[model samples]
Target: MIRTTATLLLLALPLAFTRPAAAQETPIAYTVAFPNAVHHEARIQVTFAQLPAGPLQVRMSRSSPGRYALHEFAKNVYDVQATDSKGNALSVNKPDPYGWDVTGHDGTVVFTYTLFGDRTDGTYAGIDKRHAHLNMPATLAFARGLEQRPAEVKFELPAGWQVASQLRPDATKGTWYAPNMQYLMDSPTSLGPQQTRSWQEQDRTIEMQVLHDGTEAELDSYVGLTKKVVKEAAAVFGELPEYDFGRYTFIANYLPQTSGDGMEHRNSTSLTSSRPLRGPAALDNLGTVSHEFFHSWNVERIRPQDLEPFDFERANMSSNLWFAEGFTQYYGELLLRRAGVYTDAEYCTEALSGIVDAMLTMPGPKRYSPVYMSQQAPFVDAAAAIDPNNRSNTYLSYYYIGAGNALALDLQLRQNYKTDLDTYMRAVWQQHGKTQRNYAPAQPYTLRDLQRVLGEVAKDTAFAGQFFRQHIMGHELHKYDALLAPAGLLVRPARPGQSTLAARLQYNPDSTATLGTTLLGSPLYVAGLDREDVLLKVEGQKPISAKEMQKRLAAHKPGDVVPIEYRTRNGVRTAQVTLQQDNTLEVVPMPNATRKQLAFRKAWLAGKAK
Candidate 1:
């Protein structure tokens, strides 16, 4: 019973090849196929040359690398089988939801399975007639104890499909080599016709492979702007990381067929969007690209201790998401601006949007600390299900709070010490993220580590400790107005005496307005209007729509009384609510700021250009 490898190689089909025979060789290799693209299925055969004495524990990832929540990837896998070198069947047992335990096999075993992928995002796999986007954790299965062993993966593309991934090529065509399961799982593959471009910056190479339904000229222009982003981001670290793969690939899909996401890895990022890269929607895609590119330095390597050696069987929680994800977000916009992708007005507008979301729009920060939100990421990141809890009233996304923290820190450092958050981040990169470290689960830095670094940078241990306690661990927000003073920026609320409902409203197709979340102590909250309450009438009259209610309320004075009728799960109710003056905050340029303040603001916005 000869194996299928010999026949496949003769046919020029993609084949997985192990290394030259040696002691302690790699335990596993896989060859993948796309036989039924219309059904969105991927067939994979994993051959294990060296198995443990007992049963081999092979499992699908419950959580992916760089993602915090439990995805339960095994739910998408089916048709599992195990065989020996001679193609004879072996005993396979389902021990748990994640894995199959194979026994009654010699030292060598061959496993085959089929995976169904309908979604194409950063975290999930997508297979179709045009292309196959493989998120490894969502498609591949790995043995428990073979994580340290090197692995080889080969793809049998459909017809004229070509492959683009960060995984380096081996001696064979269409095959790639990974140092270990960790690196292999972190690498996502995009196979189809692609618009590929390459460039060099310092000692590293940058590659962009896009499968977009756009012109080659548009792709080139996007790549040109992306190169500028890369240059500006490197300046923050003072240098580029010695990328292990010798290059970084931006695996992007901009067809109208895919859902949108931008996930970061050590050597590449998975960027998917339904939005095309030609019109007004193109600018929004740039933000995702820049944000994920920044992660190549931040979360991908600078290392969060809790997320190190990411677990596949359970949720991997990290409290540094505020810094890992939030700081990346802060730089995403700032670097785009620094790269000349944004005007000064655009940068301020975006920055101010974040500040307002954290300070007033989102009620999460007023009640909970940023650290608490980071800790709750396991339940909230891409979390989708039926929920009864009011997230707006109780939860603010860490990304919002963290970016706000970055803004405050940047301004405070600039005003007080003549340094900025970029300098502090560079120091962190130097200490933990340098390429030589090869950090894993036990090697990540913690909140304490951040404090230590801040203290060293600030030359004030007490100040660093207090900053963390008050701003991060504690719920107190930074003094944004005071911090922004030297930068010629001021936080101001909208004009007073114009009334507002002070609640977020979701308009349903049935012409009902449901309250989503309201600011604490605002007119909505003061009137006891709760989340999920359907608005029925305003001022004793049934409103045609939520917009009409808002327009009517905005016409009244702050002290006017408005009758509100709403329905909750319990019953219908009516109440007389005193409207509050519109107080939404805005970030504005200080008209009376001194020359020094203007200079600092320009320097902060444009970096070297200023």
Candidate 2:
């Protein structure tokens, strides 16, 4: 028999338990329990022991997986102290980086931490009038070795303070349970005060509990449309999974929410949306729900090879985050259309916007491939402008670019099989979803695996096979136009590159005869050089890629005369076009689509058909 990799081994404990202890001291484990309703405040108690000797270390996560931003949970530890049976103090200090070490003895160490009702932005207890959210990363505390050992969590509610989380309640231990620390730390609770609601669909029970000060105003919207959200999400991805089927949560934090985004999870997700759940706001909520809900079928269950047995200490690299994150993003919006929550036009508009966003803006769009980015994530750092939590913003948002590539690839797959993305994705789920828990390996699937199945919807489905190599897995952008042809869509070409006088044109695709150059928008652009002028050399040096081009340009500014060689019809012409900076780049998207585009758009928007 093949030995199971210890890393991939899932204890297979229920994700959340509402029962008591297992009563097996030799095999100690974790159990979590709480009221099964919406909540605004929570009091959690965990039982465990501190090591007898040596340096005992423990810490809350500095950052949660999936949400790449750094949210140091240690800062939220209020009134934190460790003690023994006699309530004696233990010498503890912030040792090294993200952990606290117990300097003294090993006893049943109990650490009490507090979380005051202060939620603002960036996945924490941030509150404002516009929205409030129970975003915990730097807020929740945890036990060391809990991932490997079984631990339990119990919560105490104030008055009628209802409960809301993906965890279950244990009548026995009077606590909630997780198989190990991984699930406990990975999941959190958002409760206190909120309007409560629930509905049942098939075998699964869905609750649309609401949170926020303006609870009454938006309560009806969720209550009225709870079933719709459930049905729509379930339609595309089949029934909700084991833990949560049709279970969609609508949490409102009365704080002024940041302009963009939410985080999706296995059973529940957190949203920092500015709008209410009615009218246009209601529609937005539906879309958010649809996206996160579909995650149950993709990331939550049918996951990739690298993400399983997650490595919380550092970046867990995987070549398939494109599938885990990118494809899930695709299905999130697409599920909305299948569920009738969004129109095809709306879906197309959202999908196209992302594709367009990736075409430009990102400076390193051509520098690193998706697989390289995913694999190198552990060793890379995000630039200041790229990722907010990044010590140095060097990399870009993997979700946006990676998924955009997936989008282009999906389109290619559809065209190859003369089918759509839905067909290929659903099949992958059917086969892999069965034992998804064992996923997260090095070779979850290969180029051929996707290709063989893609041909199911069409006979000559060789396009995606070529696409993965020539574009997605490589440097070139996948053939978007060719892929969209069968589906009757277009990738709307991006505006041409522009340069300044001092900045020599590094590379300009020789598509158009007219040297496509824009006025020097920056100090480099101010130089009289136009874009695509076919630079033969720079400062008497050979011109290469953009990085080298930028490096050469940064060395000189306006009024600084520099030697430049241009490949004009007049042969290599060297001239100094007075250097001036013009920092302007035009980026725009067109709302153009053919009848077929409109037809499929309608089909996707009308929600999934029954």
Clashing pairs in 1: 305-444, 308-441, 309-441
Task: For each candidate, give its TM-score against the true structure.
Answer: 0.93, 0.69
The Cα local distance difference test for each model comes to 0.78, 0.51
* Candidate 1: count of backbone clashes, pairs at least 3 residues apart or interchain: 3
Task: Give the range where candidate 2 is weakest over 10 consecutive residues by summed lDDT.
Answer: 1-10
List the lowest-lDDT window of 10 residues for candidate 1: 2-11
Model 1, 1-610: lDDT tens digits are 0000000000000112222342268546899999988999989999988676888889999887766778999999999999988899999999899999999888888999999998988788999999999889999999876766777888887787888888888755557987777778888889899889999998789999999988888898888888888888888888887777699899888877888788787788888889988776777788888888888778776877666557777877778888887777778888888989887667767665556546655668878888888898778776556867667578877777878888888887777776888889989987877744422322457899999999888877897899899889887877777777777777776564678877778776766688876667788788887888888877776666767877887779988998888998889998888888777677777778799988888889885421
lDDT of 2: 0.51
Give the residue spans of candidate 2 off by over 4 A. Answer: 1-23, 26-46, 50-55, 103-107, 114-117, 120-122, 126-137, 171-174, 215-217, 222-229, 244-261, 360-363, 375-396, 436-464, 479-606
At residue 258, what lDDT does model 1 achieve?
A: 88
For residues 64-175, could you state the per-residue lDDT of candidate 2 as single tens digits? 5454334455665545566665678877787756666665655566555544435543245543222234444444555554444545555554455555665556678666
Each model's backbone clash number: 3, 90
